[model samples]
Target: MNVVLSAVSGISASLGEDAVVGITIVILVFLFSMQRFGTDKVGLSFAPILILWFALISGIGLYNLVKHDIGVLRAFNPKCIYDYFKRNGFKQGWLSLGGIFLCITGSEAMFADLGHFNVRAIQISFSSVVFPAIVIAYIGEAAFLRKFPDKASNTFYACVPGHLYWPTFVIAILASIIASQSMVSGAFSIISQAQNLGCFPKVKVVHTSTKHKGQVYIPDINYMLMIACILVSAAFKTSTKMSHAYGIAVVCDMTITTFLVCFIMLVIWKKNIWLVALFLPFGCIELLYLSSQMTKFTKGGFVPLVLAFFLTALMGIWHYVQKERYMFELNNKISVESLGKLVNKENINRMPGIGVLYSELVQGIPPIFSHFIANIPSIHSVVVFVSIKAIPIATVALEERFLFRRMEPRGHNIFCCVLRHGYRDVLGDHEEFEFQLVHYLKEFITQETIMHEAEATTTTVEQITSIHIHTNENEVAHISHGYTIDDTLTKEGKHSSNGSSSGSITMLRVANSYSLSSSHMEGVEKEIKFIEKAMEKGVVHMLGEAEVVANPKSSIFNKIVINYVYSFLRKNFRQVDKVMAIPHNRLLKVGMTYEI
Candidate 1:
């Protein structure tokens, strides 16, 4: 509504009101459509225009200061303000305070844009360009109001020099557009951060620039905001009505920020209690402003409160459901002892290539894997259990991302790879993840070979190599108190006198990708070549598709939360594959049902 009013007022004030509403809607749609292009290209174009705006307003204010009564300078005195407020008393002055609050409506953008611009840059801009310009502009308007007492209500437009009114109107419109862009961008950043930390449902995030790490475009949020703004503009159709809602939102935003900062000071920073006491006066001032705005509750002030409440409730539900689901998975996970026993069954067949299994469990194997093995006869030659874990920090270093653990004895080839990322970490493309996983696995295999060689120094090189080769194939599926991988090697698949294993070790083209550390590199290279061949065969992703439902005996509230709200949110959110950027062609999903 404020957007439409600003545009209509500018057009009516400058170009005459031929089709003000139509013009306003068209300009708004154009601005929103330009979001896809991003602000990187357009920001520089707006900067010079904003600079000229500040210069023109400041110049006009200086001119008015000289021409009109210089006594308006007395407003800087604290006693004058106190006396004026004292004369007006609580009832009248408190009501007028609502309009005064609108002056700082977009102040939240300063903190929101901290990620895009440095703190020092923001401080410099506010102190130099924004602060003085705002002060002079208001003082100049006050001077005009004092000189022409009848024009008190419309002093801003009436006082502008006749020839410069249209130019100022154009500049004002552009500034409003920039302000709207900042608000939209800030909303996107907050939503993205919330999604990362599991406080909000997953949505699509598209990085806009390769050079700028934080530049992002969220199409879902952009379209939603555009539609909302249009609806608001249509509904209110005037700034007078919209200002109430705008004031409520801004006041609540400031109040919440105040509380958050106070919490950080006391709990996070551990500032002395006396030092923190200084903020109490500031909090009281904000509370007074909030109390003044509350008087407009029936006049659109309730809109922002309703919106805030709904969003807060939704975020809370999402966080609760996510935590509950994770706990359920953890409690139901398959133990290593149970899985090892099943792996020993001779009837299970080992297929070619690698199967990458994604699970929430960090320690035990997911029960979904057990279900998959029970139903399917053939498992992969090498299986990788990948767990993507989110840490509390801002970002995890790339070198510390992948932590590899061999689940079984050396030759088994089954491994666990944990991918740890901080809340702000960017999860890059699938190709990069696969490349890193392969690199780390190769390094682990090299270390394992060196450690084995050091332990069995008395054994002949041929004996060690043959023992390693035999253990690799047999030990993977069998686990018991007295069983060893070497025991099953003599059962079958013995190499002929030609010193080559049977059909299992069929010759294949080897890619010279790995660099070995040991002098006896030939034997290790053979093992790596075999693993590379398996990789070339293909890599498949196994995703667990679990359906969450409420138990029959559960209360109505639990049923609604678990079976309705949770289900709806999950259906709307991005799926695991899309979030992780996994390829669809090689993916397999195993289904399970849970009653929680």
Candidate 2:
């Protein structure tokens, strides 16, 4: 931003320092305000401008290379670097590395954009276009610098031919803005992933492109970044000072990435240790750059370090609190038998509606459900425990998205559903989500009925009729045919023998006739009809609003994090119901308190 302002002030003599600052403020506001339109839309609009910028730089570099000393190409050789360090003192050469590190500042943006664009497209463009153009542009600048050492401070503008000066200046400003936009977009993507992984507080995420699930916009993050950038630009007021901060941040990012890649190769991929050691040279080079930048810590390099520490602390606190809350729920979850006993109590009422209870648990009843029943003494006639899980992938197939299981104590009409969504999958269409949930539930019931009937056909009528009767919902029931219904397999439809024998007598009669009877069909139809009627009554989205408080026995640090910082973030951030896009009128919030 400072560099662009300097160019602007250079073009117009009347534009003073204050005027340049005002211009920068306006540009930053405008840039961040455009984020709501999404990455795809923004990228399309900036594509032609960036292409022209790259082409112009490439042409200018090639022209200068042919016109000036071709000997600058020797800088590519490792021996030239060795001689330069020898010619110049070692300390001076080491410090100069901080300036050279700025060249790769925006390279990480490519990795950040993998979610928004295709990998093949990024690889092809970087290898064939971006990489070559950048190399040519740098060589051209160096060659021009060799001829006129006095213009080293502003080599980019100084190297431009007189006739094309204004055109290049305008394109340069636009390209810089596009670069800033890429970092902003990457921040949004990172925060979204963090929230999905429970490492960050929930924020309102808008899916900007219907066709691309990864194209998201978060208003809160955008405005925050805009303000931070404006403040930093205003403070530094010069590109040279800002360069120190930028160099350190980029080098640190590179070092971390190198470490992660080495770890992945050695551990996750199970590659040979020797192969992993190959990355050590690159890691050492990054460390050298990092150490050089560290010398400038008091001269603007502290900015990124401060910001990184604050963000890391914030994320660490939120994740810790979330993990503790999850542990509490996991330990306190009620068994299916206990839930059945509570539901069958005479005082408890099963209301006529379909209730979709949202939980983090994939199996067993979340403690929130029991808490809701304990206080309200009522539940929906048909209850579905829905857990939305984010799997490590780009996208999940539609057919394989929902996994359904019938909760035991079969006649209670309780089911457990695990909806598996890939990291890049969008789940904002409330109407479609509700429709699919019901559709899959009905499908699961039909499939299970058919499977059980098929199994019954192979069994003897005596074995089926003589099945031991067990009325207690809390105990395991032994079937005459070596089948046992254990209370542990709460996820029905997953195991055939885990099913109840409530309709076994009808199934046996139908099997004896060597055909499925309408009576047997009616039994399955009855359950489907009940579910449809519940849906007709209306679907209510039940979400647990947990108020987490620090345990009394916790230390001061834990209390400060949980009772203050974590609480503040949770209250201010977007709530789960809003994130899920549930209708306010149809939503049922179950409030509970947790001390953990």
Candidate 3:
């Protein structure tokens, strides 16, 4: 929005003010519309143009330095700065610092955009060109102002040579657009990180580039920013007033960043005390600038603080509620021992195929799983409880990604698999997860077979017969699901004379029970087959769609926070299923209400 205003003012100064507002609106609308298409196509174009703009400004500054007062070089001396401060005294000099702060208003944006490029690139660009160009341009403007005190108010335009005004105006507009892009990109990155960290609600995230994971577009955020930008531009109508609010925002951001850096140095890196102490002055400087800006509170500086308050409150409530919900799940979760006993009960039906139940709880059973089994009579032959956990790292290696634990030893057919992912890790689709899970199960079976061989244990005929019965149970489940069998299979007795699979289902059943060792092999093979069949039949994602409500006995504040504020946020935000990319066809949402 400020970009639009900057462009409009630059063009208006030379081309008159009649169409400036309309042109600004058109330019902004077009820029916002182009967001969906992404910046990949135009990102490269910006680099050269920005470089050219810097070069042109630097060149202009050099020309102006020689043409105007070369005495501006003296202003760079520390003695000159001290003399100016001494001349103005404490109160007046401090007030002047507020206006001086505007010179670096949007500088924080460079650091915010650090994710898009490596630190080396930023450092090189800043040191080699950007820093020097900016310094020269400011010096050139100051030199021009010194030469013509009457034209001090219009210094930038006045510094421009008559012949270069139109060209510089065009470049200035382009530069503003590029600057606007940086701001928009930085906001998207922050929102995306917030969502990943559970500090903000999940919105739709569209990857703008397959090659660049950092490039993203969020429609909701983009529109909101555009509307805010437009409103600010419309209301403020000039750069002077807008600078007050902008300076406050930038200074506050710097202050927050300084504190964060200090924390990382102290807690994360455990840096030397002297190294950490170096950051104290930076924090103080930022706080000083913030204090200076706050003096203009009545002149629109309070706008950023208000915006910050609302965003902070929203994020804080979300984080608090999420923590509370996790705590509740922890306190009320069903134990693994209890689940094992329930599965072993004679009344429970152990159906065929595998069931993958997604649970938030890393240990024990999620309450939703108990509710599901209670309501639905049939249970899968092999049930796996899957928990996805986010680790505080940039990436997790595949070798360390999955941690599998068996619920019970020897044929219990229940397991718990914990999947660990980093905040920036890419989770492959459901099919990939299923494939990896099955592959790991196969590895487990092979290792168990090797261990049994090493133990030199021999299975008895009764064990073989028990394995046969288990196979029959699976066949029974398959038949119940509308499968047909031949009449010859139906005619077979409890014990078959020959172990053959030619006749029907009954023959196939006895063929797998001929010998104790073969029975063990057959059982393992059947389990694998059952898992493969289940995969083909499709995976079902069972999620607890919980609604949080305040208990009637609670205080008014609690009621409002839970029932109104949290509820409203949950209603508007995308749910976990959508964020995790669960398929709609396979998703089974078990709705539940929780009173807190």
TM-score to native of every candidate shown: 0.82, 0.82, 0.80
lDDT of each: 0.72, 0.78, 0.71
What are the C-alpha RMSDs, in order, of all predicted structures?
10.5, 7.9, 11.6
Name the weakest run of 10 consecutive residues (lDDT summed) in model 2: 479-488
Give model 3's TM-score versus the native structure.
0.80
Best by lDDT: 2
Candidate 2 lDDT, 257-346, residue by residue in tens:
999999999889999999889878999999999999999999999999999999999999999999999999899888988988888899
Q: What is the lDDT of residue 527 in candidate 3?
A: 70
Q: What C-alpha lDDT, on a 0 to 100 scale, does residue 184 get in candidate 1?
A: 73
Which rank order by lDDT, best down to worst?
Answer: 2, 1, 3
Query: lDDT tens string, model 1, 69-124?
Result: 77899989889867878999968888888889987777677776675788999999
Clashing pairs in 3: none
Error of 1 at 234 (Å): 1.3
From the highest TM-score down, the ranking of the candidates is 2, 1, 3
Better model by TM-score: candidate 1 vs candidate 3: 1
Tens-digit lDDT track of model 3 for 1-596: 66557556755565555466667767777777778887786577798889989988998898888888898898878898789889999778878778898787667667756867888988898889888998899888888877788976557767889899888878877888888888898888888878867788778876676555677789999998888877777677666677788888888888898999999999999999799898789999878878888899899988989999999998988887877887777887878677777677777897656677877766667777666777775677777777776554445555345556567644767777776665456664777877787776654554344335433644432232212212343451111110011222243222222222223222112213322355676867777776677667655666787777888998998888888898999999787676668788767777666776
